[model samples]
Target: MVARPDLTAWRPAVAGVAEVLHAHFTDHVYPMHAHGTWTLLIVDDGMVRYDLDRHEHGALSDLVTLLPPHVPHNGCPVTPRGFRKRVLYLDADVLGEEHIGRAVDGPALDDPLLRRRIHQLHTVLAERGEDLEAESRLSLICERLLGHLGRRVPPPPSRPDRSGLARRLRDLLDERVLEGLTLQEAAGLLHAHPTHLVRAFSREFGIAPHQYLTACRVDRARRLLLEGQPAHAVAAGTGFCDQSHLARNFKRIVGAGPGWYARAVREPASRS
Candidate 1:
């Protein structure tokens, strides 16, 4: 039987924004629950057993995976050697508008570049290497992912009109996609009750609170693919746990595979 775990603050921004960089190295027990957005799990050490959508998989270094929203899932460390990781919770709406990224169960890429990006994010978050310097490093890391992971637009004029909390939420998500933000976190950041914030955000955003968040991640992923990044890089750089997860989300909104879409763009002759 699946064990249901108790609730902790459940803030993805703090937990998901940067790599968790676990020092505990202990098994993590989580109960099955549905989410509003996709989650990307990046394993840095050892392996993990993930029960996602009622399916299980064991993952180790450089492995990436995506978990869709409203899909029940659970995670358990494979051993006491345990593991350390960076989890990104993707925002789906963004996927549709921008990137074709997905949120899966593990790391998005085994590529050295992807690993370097994660390490850099982790390092900046942990060491705070320098004030402006660290922030610059963090921004560059995200920009590289965007270059590798996001597609190009017509320019700022063509950008969508995302404002207020929705805009802030989306901006925050460009780097930290798969993180789940609690109602409290939302309220604290937005200065409203969890319920009020949800309603207001949904009302103003033209999508549910959670759905908006999912979009943010998806958009970034889309942009990356459009810009000529590979599937694995898109998965890791944009915060989809892995390529499979990116495929799932990409199919949902674009109605086709990212590879196929990218091919179409690259080979204009095929348009005939």
Candidate 2:
């Protein structure tokens, strides 16, 4: 008999996160141990049965499990096929110590919204130079977690004007189209919370801040392509991580790949 474990772990540049781990384990059992940071876990395949503070719990694909810091826990697969999971070890300060008890009591949360946000955060964390998007997503995730733990008080409903905030963010994005700023920097400059900034911009513009930025970059790439700049050079000039990154967003927004679009535009002149 042999054990196969596939694991990848890293410490992202984003604040409030201690580490990120993605793993798949077959025929493996974890001994009782504890972490100094909160474990935000999501199982992707199969199931994980674990014991936390002497209480047994099962981690299913749809649920988000939050194990508090310094609490002993052990995990193993619930099935013969084993389980695959993604985990984010958040810093202790990200969630106050006061909420530790609450989390321990209700470690497995069935909130779909939280699960989706955590998945999105993982995607952003995997990409380089996306710290702003990661931080913005993390802020909302923490707020939702606090709400789930019964520590966050819902804000009073007030219909104050938010169009100005959205426009300001738009202008900021436009000004820094090439060298993008972090969500924290925009919030500091505009005097708003990261979550609030995202909400305001989305509500007013009907698109997410990150999506809008990607669109802007793609639009710039189009212009450079038409000007006879190479696709790779345009991608670098327009702030994309690489040519493939540019191509993906370009196809999504422009209904064609960069190479195809460039050729199509030049084809008309060649025909003439």
Question: What stretches of model 2 exceed 4 Å from their correct place?
Answer: 128-130, 153-161, 267-272
Q: What lDDT tens digits, residue by residue, belong to model 1 across residues 238-258? A: 555578767766777778887
Query: Which candidate ranks first by TM-score, i.e. highest?
Result: 2
Q: What residue pairs are clashing in model 2?
A: none
Every model's TM-score:
0.39, 0.90
Q: List lDDT for all candidates, in order.
A: 0.52, 0.88
Clashes of each: 48, 0
Local accuracy of candidate 2 as per-residue lDDT tens digits, 1-272: 86768999999988889999999998889999999999999999999999998899999999999999999999999999999999999998888778889998999999999999999999889877667678879988998998988877345224354788888999999999888878878989998767788888888889988888888999899999999899999989999878887887799899999999988775444543
Best by lDDT: 2
Task: Indicate the TM-score of model 1.
Answer: 0.39
